[model samples]
Target: MTSTDAASPLDFPPTPAVILAGGLARRIGGGDKPMREIGGQTILNRVIARLAPQCCGLILNANGNPARFAAFGLPVVADSVADFPGPLAGILAALDWAAEQRSGIQWIVSTPGDCPFLPRDLVARLHNAQGEQDAELAVAVSDERAHPVIGLWNVRLRDELRQALISEGVRKVDRWTARYRLAAVSWPTAPFDPFFNINTTDDLAEAERLVALDATAA
Candidate 1:
């Protein structure tokens, strides 16, 4: 079992990777895109496979149809606030879970469920980027762009996040990230985006091609 210990910049512990699974998926006809099939497995399964090796634990942030996603077997968590306040609310819900799970969870790496090509070294890279800095969050970046939803969120930012969800209408991820000492980890663009997300049916088709290409490449 992984020991629960306080983390330093040098010795970060096993933090949870929270999956945002509650999106409306309007472009994909309003169902769970992450649960959609790709490469003979659910997209969510691929996500868990990629991230499970990198984090101490995992949790799903879905707000609707509990039985629909019960097969994932992760602790299915819902938004604390109301009316689906977007990924920020999902992150907050995960934070609340982490706060209750143990006293030593240092950070959370948030990822959208549809992004199957996520980095293999996500946790390590984020921990490195936030090294010894006064950073409350670290998000993944590629091609000079930041994927705000795919963030390494520190537990220290809990209060601010709670206040934001309660008092202010903080829906935009980048806006909340703006209040933190943040950094980004960049992955080269060629075969993988590490943040390639399927937002539409066309996007899923592209993912199918990518998977086929990988099959041939292998």
Candidate 2:
């Protein structure tokens, strides 16, 4: 636990993953950003494909109509905090959902729905870093920037998170994470960053190009 070296994936517990799809999407004209297509597949599909294998269970954190995401075949849980408090609320909801529905799940990994290129070893790396730092939580970093929403959360902290969201009015992810011991695991950006998110039509177009190139190589 003293070193930051990667640990075997089996060393981690059965962690569930939740895709945060409840954003307002104001940048992309207000719709489910994960629904946007990349190389003939929805961004959600690609995210699920990458994360499903690493997690014990997978769910979608989406606000508003859950029926739209039915095609993905994941249990969609909406934010428990009203008024779209932000991704923190979605994370809180995911934690609560896991606690209630998935017995024996202690950790819940969260990723933004728009991030189709999430790392294949995301859960493993985050858990490894968490153990190495002896921290309660771990977040993903790339190009020296931290993606707070993309992290591993201890389900035991859900109650504190709920209070922070409702009573303390905390909306920023970093603001909430700062209260805990955290580990930041950095990933190389070469060949493209795994945490790259689609926020606009331009990003979607670029993702199409990247996916197409990957398909050609495959």
**TM-scores for all predictions:** 0.91, 0.93
Q: Model 1 reaches what TM-score against the true structure?
A: 0.91
Compose the digit string of candidate 1's lDDT tens values, residues 48-163. 98788777789999987678887878898999889988998999989888998857887888999998877666777778778756566788888899899998888778878989
Top of the candidates by TM-score = 2
Off by over 4 Å in 1: 1-11, 215-218
lDDT of each: 0.81, 0.87
Prediction-by-prediction clash tally:
0, 0
Q: What tens digits encode model 2's per-residue C-alpha lDDT throughout 1-218? A: 22223233466899889999998899999988888888888899999988887888799998888999888888999988889889999899999998898888889999999988777778888898899899999999999999999999999999999999999999999999999999999987757777788988899888987886555532
Question: Among all windows of ten consecutive residues in candidate 2, which has the lowest summed lDDT?
Answer: 1-10
Q: In the order shown, what is each candidate's alpha-carbon RMSD? A: 4.6, 2.9
Query: Would you give me the overall lDDT of model 1?
Result: 0.81
